[model samples]
Target: MSEEQLNFDFFAELSEPVPEPAPVKENVDGADEISVEPAALSEAAAKAESSPETERGVTPFVLRQAVLGYLAGQQPTAVGIRVPTRVKKFQVSMAACWIAPQSKQNHIEKVVAIDIFDRREHCLPDCAEREELLATLKTLKLEKLKLEKVIRENEPELKDSDDLFEEFQSYDYSASRNTAYHKLLKQISRLQHVIYKGSRMELIRQAAVADYLYLAVPAGELAPEELADGWGLLHVFPDRQVKVVKVASRQQCNEEGRRHLALNIAATSLKSVLFANGVAVDEHLRVSFQPPPRRRRKRL
Candidate 1:
């Protein structure tokens, strides 16, 4: 792509007028509701501004704010944050819905998936140190297993002791050993983060929830090729400005998938409102209102 094409202005494209399709009457509830485009972006920006900055500087929350602003300027029908995708256990960071002019049915227009790299993940140790760390972690796991077995074997003997300190001392392990085990675990966690690269893009592709998919990252953090084929690249700057590094190619989404994505966005939007009003949603999708605790008044 040329420089102009690479730096495409998505908002300008969205603002351009397109021929409206023939109106067809459809029995869809809430089809005539006003678009929540600007309000959603404002809410997202407010939360991002209220949050403290991360150690590495620009946080995922800030990036989300920029992307939402970008989407809002384009005038989508509705926008949602952390929206669940059609794929189980996977969600897009942000999704925008657009209504089809002909049928007036809501469909997902854009989906953005963000990937933030933490300092530990970015500053992973060299290959030699990584191998050593893995080896140490393995040794620590074996030692932990042996210690657990010893504790289980001595459980009968310790059952008679009522003193907690005495029972802790009987475990035949030093405090330093416990500390080292936890340290190794932390290192292993960072190692896993470095190893599992592009996992976000993989999930976005698997979800395949929108007509246009975008991979958003902190400015100067990713190359255009880092995104999957047909996916767009959005660079979110520290000042909360969004730039389209690469335009996304339209993907085929059946009507069923579009409707499902739109429904997920609607559910997420509703849940946000309910939570704001002190209502809770359970795992089974049942909602309950919880009143705030009453404060006792002090008498003069």
Candidate 2:
């Protein structure tokens, strides 16, 4: 009886199906359900370790393209060009999209100045704790991205290391469980007290003088108090998706200053587009102008 009982269902229970694990709980932002594996986290960590300690900034010219796209959507007739402005005696320039008058009746020009946030110059908090956390979260996110990239690049190798191949997985998924990535994301999302002093005073000038003012910044990155002083916010993504969070308010365009800026903007633009257009300055008035085409003498 003892021998039969011992041998009875030891093999039988193994043959029966096993129960599946319960579903994971998800949070509003879906960070709580983070599912990155340790291999990915390790790869991300490696990437973060290897990357330069440079702070994230609006160094990407691609963001301007997103702003340009938005301008095209809003003012399909407008054209973008980098233009210079005088801010407290400093000749600082920024990109501007200009929409010329369609009819002579209105006779007013439209200028949209784009203020690109540079994390290197902007987005630092006076509070050391906020600054440190912001930097830490960025590093963590970069590491997470690297981990994802490494996993994708070595999918075959990972698959070959599955337990079915008489080996444990090379990737240790337990370490990077949801808590880690989600916590980092939460920290980043909750960042505050990061003040950016107008990126440039020219931004304020643009708001007062420009027909439109647009703030173009990287996706998910923002200052504590964005330069939302009636400026439109364009959150540009790597995928080229632009989200317009606020509509720009049109201010009274400065007639004299705008004309001066417009001519300079047009001349600056022509240098790029017109296959090397030279800028000419009038000495007496200190005004800039494009040279008129030279007149050819008749040949005998």
Off by over 4 Å in 1: 1-56, 103-199, 276-300
Which ten contiguous residues of candidate 1 have the minimum total lDDT? Answer: 30-39
Native-referenced Cα lDDT, model 1: 0.52
**Backbone clash numbers for all candidates listed:** 0, 2
Question: Which candidate wins on TM-score?
Answer: 1
RMSD each, Å: 26.5, 21.9
Per-model TM-score, in order, reads 0.49, 0.42
How well is each residue in 216-259 modelled by candidate 2, as lDDT tens digits?
A: 56656663223323455556566556665444656666776665
16-117, model 1: which lDDT tens digit per residue? 112222332322132223121111222332343455564537775676676777777766787787677765345666777777465665334443333233
- Model 1 TM-score is 0.49
| lDDT of model 2 at position 250 | 65
